[model samples]
Target: MPYSNESHFHPATFILLGIPDLENIYSWLSVPFFIMYVMAVLGNGAMLLIIQTEQRLHTPMYYFLAMLAFTDLVLSSCIMPKLLSIFWFSSTVIYFEACLFQMFMIHTFTSVESGVLLAMAFDRYVAICNPLRYALVLTNPIILWMGIANVIRGVIIVIPCPGMASRLPYCVTNVIHHSYCDHMAVVKLACVDTTVNSVYGLTVVLLVIVFDVIFISVSYAMILRTVYNLPSKAARSKAINTCTAHICIILLFYTLGLFSFLTHRVGHSVAPYVHILLANYYLLVPPVMNPIVYGIKTKEIREKAFKVFYKKV
Candidate 1:
């Protein structure tokens, strides 16, 4: 059987930003955004190189860390270039297909990041709670499967996105208020019924955010129990310290995410700009902060990165 034509419908314009009206705002925001983007790229790129070159970082934990860094690079790349263009060049018009592609990739990477975080949590849980079996449990085969599982989860969850986007009928307006083709922003422009799109989006959030958080929490709780049971004070401190960075990252990502979702949904037109700002932070913070957090917290990674750069110089 042939595939359906459900994916071919195109919208008129990809963006909704009123360029002339926001020239000053764009100019002001562009300076800081450009700096942030450059830092994110450099920081994440450096971490990726360090992970690849440093033999000490060849463990399962660092494998996931490298994956996370790669995801952050993609995530920031997906949004920042276009945003910088809008600010510097006054080019806010995105093609329909480009917008769809951007939305797909953004969601795909974000979902994969969530899955990767879950895998990391599981790794920490096993390492702390089942120390004797940590090596056996997180064997090469298991790490490979975990990577495959994340990719599968990302693709599967976003399967409905293209269909939902294609079905929407764009009538009058096509200007998206935000920097990128976010799910809610695009769906709001559809003249046709948007029930399907909203339902699918909510379903995805429930799975990725709700379900994933519950599992991560359970894993951490078990980890805490195991930490307390450790007979040696130094052992307990070391175990808790290892989890500190991951815990901080989880708290930041989820808190910002929940705030963005709630503010976007409840604030309406009164605070659209606020919502945009918050959403931008959600995308940018992880990429810029993850490398710094890991570098400062993980002594081996920090030392390896310094040594690699020192040798190069």
Candidate 2:
């Protein structure tokens, strides 16, 4: 809140670097980003539409997928428009409050997605290991509470992020060498020591991403045992098939997340551009890929999506 005595004025703006070292070719890069953005939107939108209108999709798995689609839609929409604007129009200026708000939204949605994946893992575990009680285990009331708990956890944990960063006196540079206002990237620009922010960031990741990954892994371990013990190959194959889409999603989401986390922490070994690029990929890839993966791997949703479209024509 207070400016450094040296500057005598609190900084009020931050500049987001669209993509470091690529300003000369931002126009060239915009094409693919634009295409991915459009595809993510349309694909996720279609997934939501079909899941909403199709009666057969009114199940726990599809319900979680719908939540995933909605999260992706929000996640992509929050970042890409500003990123594209920066790339094309060179509109890199972001107000201090706006930057913090963007950071909050990004982190919040990320946590929500992680929680959703964990929910899906549990959904599979119940359906596979306790088929008779699947309905009772993951009823609408339980699912709704899981969703609410995920969101509340995100909000309560992430509140300190922007607050910590904003309270620091940014005396020198306000230029963030990243496309959007990420927690780490923004806090690094502060002239004061950022150990608190850094530690808090790491803690958040450990609690949300790492903890979820471990839980999902354990759930799938149990799932594999259950499926393997099935008396018939048909039953085993059927169970595994049902989990395929969720498995792909979990792999994509966490792999990119861990990579980005590592790159941010120890990426000094590589080019800064490499870190920057991976950071962008870490955020963008899941949103673009999740819908495509689900659309292809999950048969019912895919067929229903086709039906939904065909009816319009």
Candidate 3:
């Protein structure tokens, strides 16, 4: 049996090869992956709950955090069920529209999450460097608009991706090499020249890394300078501590993202399983750790989380 170069002008379904060359061990792998999904859901869900119920967590910082948690929830939820089916039941076929939808949601939410991280950096910068105007600068209406703006940005940036991919002729093979319907993985299966899709995909990755990381880096740099010049040691330590969770999360998120992106293009020598595993972790680990980092590193979140669970504040 051989696949000819038959062009599917409108493919009905595309087959997914979950974690290429690891089909035999998908059941073994699914356990930990499933646990991660559960942890992400519970952790982010709890963050949202605590942020909403607690009166003290109503400020601009917590508002942005709530949005982050919500984004993580959507990100994980969108991919896990279909992915788990592939892992557990060998249900690797996804309808063409569903695959495109998954690609759109994953990329859009990831972009939105990056925007949220950038927004958090801005919040921290204002809180530390411009404390006097924090209240005025970050009003509830302003925070609301920030959330709206991030969503709009994500939608605008990612809408063209699926449209461009859909128009391409996927005539060669329908077997997507990764677990989920990743954008590049889908587009690579196209028979025609995918230069535009390739360039656009690369551009999207570069845009996210360049803009979000640079602004975040700048914000934290100024924050450090302000903290360094604080009048007292105690004040300096407190300011630094306030930003620890955010800094850790930024490092974790971006490092994973950079590696995943590089592997697709430059890391041709990398094993397919290795690349696929990293891609899966890039999406799952951040969601799983965001709540943990915020819970452990942010004192207020830690205390409230414990109080909610044990009734011992």
TM-score of each: 0.93, 0.96, 0.96
Candidate 1 achieves a global lDDT of 0.84
Candidate 2 Cα misplacement greater than 4 A, ranges: 1-9
Residue 280 in model 2: lDDT: 73
Better of 2 and 3 by lDDT: 3
Model 2 C-alpha lDDT per residue in residues 65-177, reported as the tens digit of each score? 89999999999888999999998899998888899999999999999999999999999999999999998999999999989998999898888898787787777788888
Best by lDDT: 3
* Native-to-model Cα distance after best TM-score fit, residue 188 in candidate 3, in Å: 0.9
Off by over 4 Å in 3: 1-8, 311-313
Mind giving the per-residue lDDT tens digits that candidate 1 earns over 214-264? 999999999989889999999899999999999888888888888888887
In model 3, the clashing pairs are: none
Q: lDDT by residue for model 3 over 1-313, one digit each (tens)?
A: 1332245474778898888888888899999999999999999999999998999899999999999999999999987887899888989988888999999999999999999999999999999999999999999999999999999988998989998988888767888998899999999898788899989988987887799999999999999999999999999999998899998999999999889888878999999999989888889999999999999887778888888889754
- Output the TM-score of candidate 1: 0.93
Name the TM-score of candidate 3: 0.96
User: What are the clashing pairs of model 1?
Assistant: 16-175, 16-176
Q: Model 2 misses residue 279 by how many Å?
A: 1.4
Clashes of 2: 0
